[model samples]
Target: MSQATPPRSRRVPRAERREEILAAAARVFGSKGYRAGSLAEVAEQVGITHAGVLHHFGSKDRLLWEVLEYRDRVDVEHLEGQHIPGGLELFRHLVTTARRNADRRGIVQAYTVLTGEAVTDGHPAADRARTRFGVLREDIASALRTVADERGVDLAEQDAVRAASAVIGVMDGLQTQWLLDPEVVDLAESTAFAIEAILRAVLPGVEPLPDSPGASGAP
Candidate 1:
């Protein structure tokens, strides 16, 4: 009798394969800093060759940028309409995200690692990181201004920018500490407290910003 022929492997869809590669790359770069992680390791995890990874992403630099964008997508994945909130709602959304992030250590780790790496001289992700910070600061400052306007309080532009920077700094600093010792630092609760304090300081005499409708119900 003739030997039975082996079945051919099924091919994954392009979009699905790209997502798989992105996830694998995130884990690799999370565990091993971007400078240390290799495309071959990502390919090995995805059961593909290094050349296959390049075929999808062109270069490791492009792949790194894609991975960063993928992380941003995940950030708003749970929001209704995938839209980030503004005004007081933005603060609530941020606290909600911090709460959600406690369960997503891998993504948080990847973010923290890449951010730290981006500060190095001539880093490939330096520009991307800088742009991300600039956008976040602007968004947060805009939100602060909105809250101030709604409360009939006048918030100076520089003050709003400074407050925004403080909020961002606290959140990122807490993430780093929590990653190192989860048993000691409560990332979600601490973030909420810090944000609330900042708001109270910035908008003195204003009643606490009421939660947006159904905001409490967000996961």
Candidate 2:
């Protein structure tokens, strides 16, 4: 009897292997958190030895930063080619972001855990996190200013800055709650409601942010 040839395995490129490792690392860190997540778990997920993972990523801290960068890259891509969003548009965008986050617990958890860790002075990602917040604040302030101008509301720059800060606070706080008790908290809906309230205080009679289609509400 003629022997059947063994199936040949295709070799992944070096870059491809690195990407696969990063994806597995993100999932592990997201689920187990940075301190609890281990290199072995990540390597196992990627079908590699622990040393192989280190060969690709150099160190766990560097890997964590890369994972965060990957998440941010994906997020920026999600908003690519979109129009410059104003107040209501910005709120809608944020609610949409929350809804999307609900589906990706891993990434959200990683971000949440890392942000808390970054508070310690001289943490590896501390500067990166602070820079990210600065950029977000600027974006929110710009949107607020646009909305105020469009509504003919006399909102001071300082007021807009404060409002931007409050908006970030609300989003992060709600995300933490939703992570802790997803069944009790509807992140997207709650965020939308809070944003609407803020808008009402700033621009009375302004149109509401649009609802997410097919959203399960509080579920």
Candidate 3:
């Protein structure tokens, strides 16, 4: 006899459910921008109630910060244990990052929006933006130092700092352009060219980065 068919289970582990909420938030916030994004939309996407999303994040502001942190965490994981001392390896990794971003436009857009919004007088992510930029510059400077030391080149600390800032600026700008008109700007190729050009000018004997689909010949 076909007895009782058990009911379909609808349970998710806490960690997995939280991740699902964050993913939904990222997509909603990415598409609508922070100010316009709503927890209700995220809840709908996750098949949970608005309160459920809040149960994981507490508030919309907190959720935004969590989403940003998630983006950074993903990026860090991508580079973990690579042990890239400096120079070409760094550029190669940066290019790879851009390529990965091409397929994850939502993540890219979310960060871009948060960056713009964070520039206001008071914003939930202002501190995070400040800390993130500081850390990014230090990491980039470390790469520059590693290359300089290995090649017996003399690069002033200030120069490395400036170069690091320039690298981030170029990358962010390229990302903005790419988002607006992907046909006009190939993020990975343009970013590779920009970074390689800076390296060649500042550090002689820097080996050329390999050819990539977007990188035409570096100038």
Candidate 4:
């Protein structure tokens, strides 16, 4: 009998293939960091050539950007209406996200790695990181202002921005510590505590949400 040729692998749809590539790239970059990770490694994970990845993403820089965007998409994927919440609900949403993140180490790793790398001079992700922080600061600040208004408090704009920065700083700082020593740092609990503390400092006399983790008498 004549030798039979093996059938080629089935082709993945363009959209599906892009998702696979993004996922594989996230893992590679998360473990290796963006500067250390390679397109070849990302390609290997997806069972494709390095050129195949380029064909899909155009360039490594673009791929890194897309991966960051993909992370943001995942963050809000579970939200109702697929959008970030505003006002007091935003704070609750953040606490819920931190709790959810405890189970998503890889995604958190990718975010931390990329954010750290974005601080370097001439980094491709510098602009994106800066823009992201600016937007988040504004969003959080706006939320704080809304809460203040609801409580009949006159919160200054600068104070709101300051509190927003502190909130973001504590969250990012805790992620680094947790990634280094998860056994010692409870990412979700510590995040809830820090956020509550910041809110208390910024909005004195306002009570925490009834169901918040910090409302359970967490120190």
Task: Give a tens-digit lDDT track for model 3, residues 1-219.
Answer: 112211225578899888877877777876676567899988877777898888999998778878877765655453546333355567666776676666667667767877888989988678988998898788888888888988889999888999889888888889899989999999878988888887776688687676433433332
Tell me the lDDT of candidate 1. 0.79
- Indicate the residue-level lDDT of 106 in model 4: 55
What is the TM-score of each predicted model, taking all chains together?
Answer: 0.76, 0.75, 0.77, 0.76
How badly does each model clash, as a count of residue pairs? Answer: 0, 0, 0, 0
Error of 2 at 183 (Å): 2.6
lDDT for position 18 in model 2: 80
CA error at residue 11 for candidate 3, angstroms? 5.9
Model 4 ranges with Cα > 4 A deviation: 1-16, 24-48, 58-65, 209-219
Note the Cα lDDT for every prediction shown: 0.79, 0.74, 0.75, 0.79
Q: How well does candidate 2 score on lDDT at residue 120?
A: 99
Identify the runs in model 1 with alpha carbons over 4 angstroms from their true place: 1-16, 23-50, 58-65, 205-219
Which candidate number would show the highest lDDT if scored against the true structure? 1
Candidate 1's clash total is 0
Q: In candidate 2, what are the lDDT values of residues 84-125, reduced to their tens digit? A: 255566677777777767776666776787788899989877
**Is 1 or 2 the stronger prediction by lDDT?**
1
lDDT score for residue 41 of model 3? 84
Off by over 4 Å in 2: 1-18, 27-38, 44-47, 82-87, 211-219
For model 2, give the 10-residue run with minimal summed lDDT: 1-10
lDDT of the structure predicted as candidate 4: 0.79
What order do candidates take by TM-score, descending?
3, 4, 1, 2
